[model samples]
Target: MTPNQATSSTTAHLKPTLGSLQLWGIAVGLVISGEYFGWSYGWASAGTLGFTVTALFIAAMYTSFIFSFTELTTAIPHAGGPFAYSKRAFGPLGGFFAGAATLIEFVFAPPAIALAIGAYLNVQFPEINPKTAAVTAYLVFMTLNILGIQIAANFELAVTLLAIFELLVFMGVVSPGFSMSNFTKGGWAGQDHFSLASLPGMFAAIPFAIWFFLAIEGVAMAAEESRNPQRSIPIAYIGGIITLVTLAIGVMVFAGGVGDWTKLANINDPLPQAMKLVVGDNSNWLHMLVWLGLFGLIASFHGIILGYSRQIFALARENYLPLFFAKIHPRFKTPHRAILAGGAIGIAAIYSDELIKIGGQSLTANILTMSVFGALLMYIVSMLSLFKLRRTEPHLVRPFRAPFYPYSPAFALICACICMVTMIYYNLLIFGIFCLFLALAYVYHAMTVGKRSPMQDEADSNSMTTKTPAR
Candidate 1:
């Protein structure tokens, strides 16, 4: 096997053009799609009030998770994000699992967002088939990502501002017509009143709650490309989380309050649907929402494609994946191969589900849950990494630290465990598929890379005179 002597140089060699504001733009832009859809899916599992309760629980989880996670990002400041942390804390195998989960989250996420983009456009102009629109969205964004980080970050900033504005406008327009009665109309769908039976629904609703804040951690993936990741990572990470929580609550209360929350549950474009109900089909608000609301989905879809490429590039640079994925454009200095490769995977995922026509349901939600499953699993592993690192590598420099030390990471870890179990319970089919993929990856690593796990590799590197890859 080729040793990772060049890994450090190649990984750290990435261009660093991103500032704190651009990082904030990418962080927020990466997740603004959550404000668009999928959170309402929780309502299908638990009604409006129950879903709101679930949101609050998840908000706590994310608040704690980001605080704990930021310290790792600031301290480590690697493009691999969770993979680097887990590798440092646990070893190659742990890093693989963490990386795989992140891959599952990022590689699978854009297609879902692409599907949403199509759905949003289709709602405005039915002549546009969602499948066609989704493919187009992938092609356009992949091109933008391939151009350069500077261009991508600038675009992310512009659209992120528009998406944030759109959400505020949505809340304002919907608030005037919101009825408290409508909010509680279906607070708990299956339960006449609160009961023990209602508990599982809350657990089941966890993934949907995750929809509100998924991919926020992806900001860490841009560490190699950031101007001053040490200072910028914490601000962008914390600021992004705060912005999302407020939007999550505002959209939840206002949208549910405007009309039948149950009807809006699980739909592709809940905001537009909710607005149309309140202002009629031809209302200016509906027009503005349908036209501009696309920005929210586009922001996330575009931003996530950028994130996934960096992750793919990072892993490949470390020899965790094929070397071909590590290739950077000579002129652009971007991981063009990784970007195209991820786009190909996303497009294939979109069409495979489209052709199979899974159980007469749109694969968008299923794929979404699948991505959430990966994210929750990664979160659990990463929080564990934080504690492990603190114990084992206490002297490592940390520009930022979690406010509550053990408590913050501990709380996030616990919540991540619960959310992961909940995600598995809710998404058995996808979980099974992910397991099969994991087993195959392990088999491939054992045979090709030999039995030397990431831990062993790190040990080897430390003892060797040759320079090792960046963590």
Candidate 2:
């Protein structure tokens, strides 16, 4: 088949159905799970004070990145997200790098969130195993995604709002118990003095700090399906960052001050644990948090399932992976094959949590590190793509230019570089495994996709095009 024909075929398969509201839901929902669990792990390594600093620093990087990244998403409007942006800027190899990194981020994140979901359920029902609960979640959400985009997105919106409200309620309930003295007690990584010793712990906490806002960028994967990409994408991304930052700081500080922050640091359900200190374990507020908290984890898990499937579909559509994954379900008009494939991988990872351990870390901790590795890499490649495209494609219609031009992207790039270096330094073993995953994927991509011809490039460019931004 000709390149033109392939582009035309892909266009017919993916339908635009999302509006700004749904996009906002997806953006926030993609990372809300971070508040519920993962960020607590940072306390184990960095203490409350140390992790708070790391969270604030990482939050700055995301704020700048979302502002800059909105430009590329508006111009390209491709479901491939970072992959599409990088490909247009630097060609196929760049696309592979960004795509692999994104895949690692989106694909691995769900398993960790799924495990959290299982743990949350285990609290309510002692009989159910967390792994079994996790696997059940994978099956259920994947089916929801395969049903259709609107169905999946509407469901995402509902859960995201519920999750956000629950978080706010948590803060209110814990406010009476919050004390600055408690928060600052041994806050400097268990040291009374803020010496050079705290630096290592602070830097080592980058991944968990990153967890607070990770995958919020996955909203870009829905651009193709957004009713108005230029407007909705910006709103979704900007609003998402602000909401997450506020919640992260609020939740972390409140959780820390209410009780023995050390105990909350290493567990999956920190909010409930902290709440128990404020109100006894039998309190309804504690029960409410345990039950409603599932919404936070579910929102992210379900939204990421949507994100990863679109990514898989885009890569397959562009021939970066097997074409089998590119097929759309005729009745549902969704990437059913891609949805199932990603689910299979996640389910495997869920089970492997017990079977695999590296550096004495659980699969959840290792995958969280691995996910951050991918996020940082994708952030770096994406910023470079932004700069390259500005220099090269001077005429690309940008409805929303990044607020500070070079400065915004430059700041984001530098922060991502620092975080990447810190993560690599602290997680050498996981870093090596991340590299091996990319290397293996690249080997397959090189052998199969090879180099793109001029005709194919033109077709990809055409395929990615959508409505122009209103001047």
Candidate 3:
């Protein structure tokens, strides 16, 4: 069957289903825009030493970790995503922390992406205010998202292809100028180079490198909306990561070869600068390609917002959040209210100057480490939940079981722990601050809201029923 016919068939099987291609598109867009650009920016700052090693490390980590997630997501394709899986596997509270951390990651990621767009815009239009661009991009995507998921998904697909194509074409055009010798120009700089006495600076670079791999988890967030999520979600998760890793490595290698490592390292927006070198000055066509890539960035923001809003909607439905956020639009069959709430947060984040500062750090260096810290917390809980559920619900009909049983889950947990230790050792202050916020949020949520059960609402509804007087 043709693509349209296939999509129609898939849609008929499940209401509110996102086709596999669209799911892939959403995953790609979210990972590329939300994670990749920031990652590349981070890599740029660390120079070749950090980039080369960290890229390899991330590729290894992502491959192993994703297989584990694919198993979980495919087994339990619920709206709550990781939160739902955790609840079923561990317990409500375990699920709560997982949901909370995932929520924070999704919430924080959009602003970071928005700030990247604003930074790129600042480069092209030096006269335009960065804050204004950031706010405008956030609002535009927010509006796009509010229209509904289909619109957002379609836009994501289009921009994802555009972004990939732009990068590929740029690479092809610049391939002729590739010079392998440039790679070694900036040989590994020691700790003394950055005024540090020991190897802490080298270790400091891990988080930045880790940042490049951040959005591989986004596929789980799209589980509820995916067409045949049991199959599609896993595929998207695995495929999206592979695609990103391949493209990223290719672009970085090609860009590194085109000029001395120092030149590419110095330019904040490497693609446009690389294009300038290849296409020469006054290349408006290349400028237009960069602009299209920026739109892809914006589309990436929309995809994350789409995934995140659904996550919040799922939480609210479970009574973990306010009921108001749970309301879906009647006609559109979309989580309209939750989308607005997520967008509002993104807009608020644009106002923070600190976001810009954080965005400038090395990809494999700082943010990645911190993000991994948060992601690892969720992963550990998720893996433990997998084991917890195996014992608790022995007969639970899992469509897809993780390979190697306890070994798989055990391995994932170990990897997560290792990443967590690395994060703490590398940047204790930032990681500690994030944990503190999570702790405070949990305490406040527990004290004020957790005590009340969803069952109480049903009981109250029964009690308020009108009784007819004896007639």
Off by over 4 Å in 2: 1-12, 354-356, 450-452
Top model number, lDDT: 2
Question: By lDDT, highest first, what's the ranking?
Answer: 2, 1, 3
Per-residue lDDT tens digits for candidate 1, residues 367-399, read 887788789889999999889888987767778
- Model 2 residue 229 CA deviation (Å) reads 0.6
Sorting all predicted structures by TM-score, with the top scorer first, yields 2, 1, 3
Structural similarity to truth (TM-score) of each candidate: 0.94, 0.97, 0.83
Positional deviation of residue 79's Cα in model 2 after best superposition, in angstroms: 0.6
Per-residue alpha-carbon lDDT of candidate 3 for residues 1-471, written as tens digits (9 for 90 to 100): 233222211221113558888888877887776322544443344555555665666566666667777766776665667877786655557767888877777776776677677767876788988668877887787778777778878888898998888777767887887877654455344221333332343444455555556656777766766767766876787778888788777877777677755555423366667667767756875677568768657766778888778778767665567666777777667777888897787677567446423534432233334455667678778888777777876656555566677676677677667667766775666677678868886785686454344454333222222132211
Question: Which should have the higher lDDT, number 1 or number 3?
Answer: 1
Return the TM-score for candidate 1, rounded to 2 decimals.
Answer: 0.94
